[model samples]
Target chain A: MNPLRWLVGRFPTLALARRNLSRATLRSALAITAVVIGVVAIGAIGTGGEAFKQDQLEAYEGFGGTATVEPDVQFEDGNLTNTELSDGDIDRIRQAAGSATVLPVHEPAGSFVQTQSGTLLFRARVKGLENPGEFYEARNGTMPDNWRRTIVIGARIADQNDLEPGDRLRVNVTDEFDRSFEIAAVLKPQGFSAPLGADRTVFVPASEFESGGYEQAIVRVDTTTGSVDAATQAIEREFNAREQLVRVEQVQEQREQFTEFFGTVNQFLIGVGAISLLVAAVTIANTMLMAAIERESEIGVLRAYGYPKRAVVSLLVAESTILGVVGAAIGAPLALGIGMAINQLLLGDPFAFTAAGLRYVGIGVGFGVVTALVAGLYPAWKAANKRPVEALD
Target chain B: MAPEPNEDDGRWQEAGDHATSETIPTDAIIRGTDVVKEYETGGQIVRALKGVDFGIAPADFVAVVGPSGSGKSTLLNLLGLLDVATSGDVRLRGRDVSTFTDRERTRKRKETIGFVFQSFYLIPTLTALENVEMPRMLDRTPTKTRQRARQLLERVGLGDRLDHYPDELSGGQKQRVAIARSLINDPDIVLADEPTGNLDRDTGDRILELFDELRRDENVAVVTVTHDDYVAEAADRVVTLIDGRIRETESRRANFEEGPDP
Candidate 1:
């Protein structure tokens, strides 16, 4: 007899087994539901972690945004402790790489500002007097061309002091340098900062700085440049040719550091997902074992009818696989939706579903199938080895 | 006894008279010589079959009658290939089945010997007709198994009970379904272990009549294990077993006139 035909002929028997499973509908549903929860947990964790990592990578890669430039020097102990960039060197850089924005800037060493209502201590960052209006324009107020008599504080400080764009405040640079100035504007808080103490930044015109030269140059590009890498390379080449006594840092580096940090977190999440899938495998095996024990006599009857050992094993594994498939069919889409929801929550807005990060879905399905297959082995074996006489008795 | 012809030891014999034939061959539908079967339970050996010898031929209806634990059921099991003999040879169609492996024995049982159990071991999930078709499902017969099974059911006076499950059938109807199942493979011999044991006397007599009709028409050898004298009387020949050995074989003619003697 054709083995395939025999198997096909046994469909009624398999249907009988299926019917038996449905006999205790509630128990069967509960068992399958446990498997479903395990499947969903596995898929969601896996895909969710991958989506988060992808989003973080995009943010770090800047998603085709502007290249950044800042000082490479570190300042310490109130002295010109780091490499100083001369105004002439800044001029040479601005002329050499016009593609990059070179904002010749200075920060007042550091100081405290006290309004009549409350005292706010702040570090003063200065934009160049040449085009301070171009870069330092605030959301609430305009930057003053002559910034000696006008200054803008960060949004938080302005809010705390109840100051507006036209409000006048006593700005104490120091006891000898205390001068009353109009609050020209308050700039919006630009999120968290790395160097710390950024919330207390006070913007002033660079020309008012008492230092002989500027500390560093802040450069912003039009983002429509040839490429960020190309622009950075061009600026580096120009600075090297002149052998200028200045160092340039791309803001993209800070973004890259953030990406790397979150990438590790993504790895941890993937590990967590893998562990959940492993646990799901155990749950499936345990449930199948119980099912096999309950139906031992039925299996014996099939054997008496001349069903081969392979047939018994195949039937059992097929049942487990069917359960796994059902669970995954429900779980895969659920995980995708939940993962997207979580991403939206974290980003404060919904993100597009990107097809590039689809490995997570594959991982989920593959894990479910492989885990279910592994779980089926022992139960199938037990079913196959059961003696027909013993089971019937 | 009249000078009986030295007939072919295994050939089919006609009813009412042991009219042996030269053209036909039997080669012993079932022949057991000095078969002994024992079991060990809690360190005590229980001998189920002790030095028993029996011979049955094609178309010969032999009833093995014995009390409980007299090894009648054990002899039927051995003959039906459902169990093996501990010692001695059980030759069916000239082949000693004692050395056959389980798979070989299953194949032999399916193809050459049919079994009707005392409990009417019908597949509960299947209807009467489907249960009849089961043995055919195992066979590689070219005939449409379901059609053949339906004919067998109708033949056993269960034409209308084809779709009725075993649970829905009466005790007698269930045995009729089992009989149909046994004949599905067209086996040369049928081994019935107390087939009517679970039915009432009236129903059991009807079932025995059905078996007798089938044996006469199909010319298939029947070896039934029964403790009931009425059941044994229906057979063409009766073999009484006491203490796990055949005590005597009485001819149907003599049994018809004398009834059963203890």
Candidate 2:
């Protein structure tokens, strides 16, 4: 006995539906293919987005639990002033910080870099910091604890210019103040919280800046320095006691906002994928309607032979539902394979499957089956409601 | 079955109540009282059947014969309970089927009547055995429906072709499968419409023999509507219809002229 026939032996309605769909092999297969495509569209895109988000979050691993302190500028007589924090304020910040590494940043300057193309085709942002070791990791060379003159280049800048440690870079701070500095290290690529506050930036010693107040200060807090909450509170109390003179922006709040934004973006991508399934639903409905029209005489015989209207409806709906289940069963694994391929291509790991991302497969399968059932509803009702008199006539 | 004349002549007319519903035998399995069926097409009321009475009793082989458009098909639809008359009443096994709701009519039809079509409309994808099992598919009685379907097929001389699909079977075999299907529910009456119109005379004779066996062994009544005189000659009763009316009922079997069954 055929397995389908054996399974549906007691339920002839199901057996009839199975046989009917099988008779129109090409049409049924095409409908199933549409469902499969819809499922893969949703699943693969969702999983790929999840992998991308995971890689980004990993980049920000150590960037959290830190805060930045910047002077709140005040305009006096339409002239902006009070832009930088004074040395006296730095001393007070150190006293209130309680072992948190507070590195003062100087004003950033832009200059052209000599590229391997024999021209200054690239620009680099030169940011001065009292200590670069608190924010960045060295990919090639070492970051000296007390370096006063050496500069560290970002990974992207090093890649673009074929520069490494021990390379010399000529810079002109002023018309007459021309100097040379050695490339001490090539730093690893940073995430959203870059040390110099931008991609492809270069960092030098704060002593390079001539006679200037601090532009901003980044306070790194961990278990060693106490909770981030306590650090932010202490700095905020010391700087903004009487008025809002300095702004203390916590990395934790920024991370939360970034997460919310990423979630919205992911939902938008999934919604775009769902439209393909909506189109697939219309195709399935069309297929069922065609089947109904083609089988009018068969339906008439059944109706006339005492098969109730409910049984007729059940048979039609079952045919569409079977298509959905088979399509989803095939599409889900295919989608997962696509997702793994994407991960391997981007993150260098084929098994970098996230729990949230894997759920998209289940979601895709659910949507496939439900969409088919809903699409089949009208066709089933239309076929079942037809009068046996007219159908037989 | 071979187009033989009356084996038992001197058949009674039962109080001369030949073509009207004024008198009915208590053993009658189905009785229609002046049923009138109408249709409105293009806002024009076209009467298909105009006030005609029909009846059947157990083991009776009835043939409703007339030319095309003479309302033979309409009367068959009423007898099968696939439709209701626009006026008058149709009673199936003593119940007024004309007054029944759609669901009730369906249930009554399934239990009381079986249908056989001239074209033998077996589901093309199903094997002969499965086709025979179609009518009993919705039965919740938990019986061995498959085994019963096999037995019915065997009875119709289709035992070796049970696994063949309708398209694979010959016309005679397909009709036999349909016959088995009609008997699946053990219905009280088998309503056949143009049953042999698509078959050769030899095959039609075999189908008539099967009907005769069913009537003799199972006591099941059969009502066949046809324009074939050869088929009409084989029935125990011939109800001639013309112009939406029963022109005459030439019955070979005698019906009681008195009251109900004793």
Alpha-carbon error at A45 in model 1, in Å?
A: 3.5
Clashes in model 2: which pairs?
none
A283-349: candidate 2 lDDT, tens digit per residue:
8999999999888878877887777888889989989998898889999999999999989976779
| TM-score of every candidate relative to the true structure | 0.67, 0.84
Give the worst 10-residue stretch by lDDT in candidate 2 chain B. B1-10
Model 2: CAPRI class: acceptable
Question: Model 1: how far is B194 from its true place, Å?
Answer: 4.1
**Distance (Å) between predicted and true CA of B190, model 1?**
3.8
* Candidate 2: residue A156 Cα off by (Å): 6.0
**Model 1, which residues run further than 4 Å from truth?**
A1-17, A23-31, A57-97, A101-220, A234-298, A332-374, B1-26, B38-47, B59-74, B98-101, B117-125, B135-143, B165-172, B224-230, B236-262
Q: What is the lDDT of residue B217 in candidate 1?
A: 68
